[model samples]
Target: MYECYLTFRSITPCQQAQRYLTGQSLRSQLLRTPKSIAFKGCGYSLKLNDTAIGLAAAKLRQANISYGSAYRIYSDGRVEELYL
Candidate 1:
């Protein structure tokens, strides 16, 4: 299973994005941004499958929801930005 982290500037947008994705039938969960990449003390993000990444990002973009960035998470705990 492929996983990716969708980061946001703040919690509200992060939550909004999560709800929005769910409405679009994409499975997502609110999660703390990995400590190594977190921007603030309580940074939050949306974790979703890679298969849904493109559509989720597109929906957020269409809704004008802002996101910080996206990262593909590896099983070994490594991460790399998803260049959308």
Candidate 2:
């Protein structure tokens, strides 16, 4: 499985924010695989293709998606954040 790193100032799960992650705005969806990824109560996540990580974050940020950054999370637990 491919992994991505994402940072958030807050992980407190606001209603709208949560919905956004699951919404149709992007083909990506929130990470449901608990062991694979973690999402704080009020934060947002985007699970897109590994290669699209850069473009996804960029386009999302350009669209005003609230997030600190996004990255690739390897099986070894290494995380690489890409700033949008």
Candidate 3:
């Protein structure tokens, strides 16, 4: 399975995004933004399946929720930055 990580400006937006995604029928998990990718310290993020990435982004856009960045994580542990 493919995975995607979406970063938010702060924990609040991250949590909000999680709830929004859940209500939209997408599964997500809350996790800390990886230190290497996080420009700021200790920010929260949402971990989601790749298949839901597009729909999730669209919903977040429609809801006017902003995100910092996104990344696609590979099975072998490599990560590629994603433009939503």
Best by lDDT: 3
Clashing pairs in 2: 3-73, 4-73, 5-71, 11-42, 12-42, 13-41, 13-42, 13-43
Residue lDDT tens for model 1, 21-82: 88889889898888756755668888887888878998899999888888887777777888
The 10 consecutive residues of candidate 3 with the worst lDDT sum are 33-42
- As a whole number from 0 to 100, the lDDT of residue 83 in candidate 1 is 72
Candidate 3 lDDT over residue span 33-71, tens digit each? 876567777798898888788788889999998888888
How many residue pairs clash in all the candidates, one count each? 0, 8, 0
| Per-residue lDDT value at 16 in model 2 | 36
Q: Model 1, residue 6: what's the lDDT?
A: 89
Candidate 1's TM-score reads: 0.86
What lDDT is obtained when candidate 1 is compared to the true structure?
0.83
Query: What residue pairs clash in candidate 1, if any at all?
Result: none
All predictions: root-mean-square deviation over Cα?
1.7, 4.7, 1.7
Candidate 1 lowest-lDDT run of ten: 34-43
Query: What lDDT score is found at residue 7 in candidate 3?
Result: 88
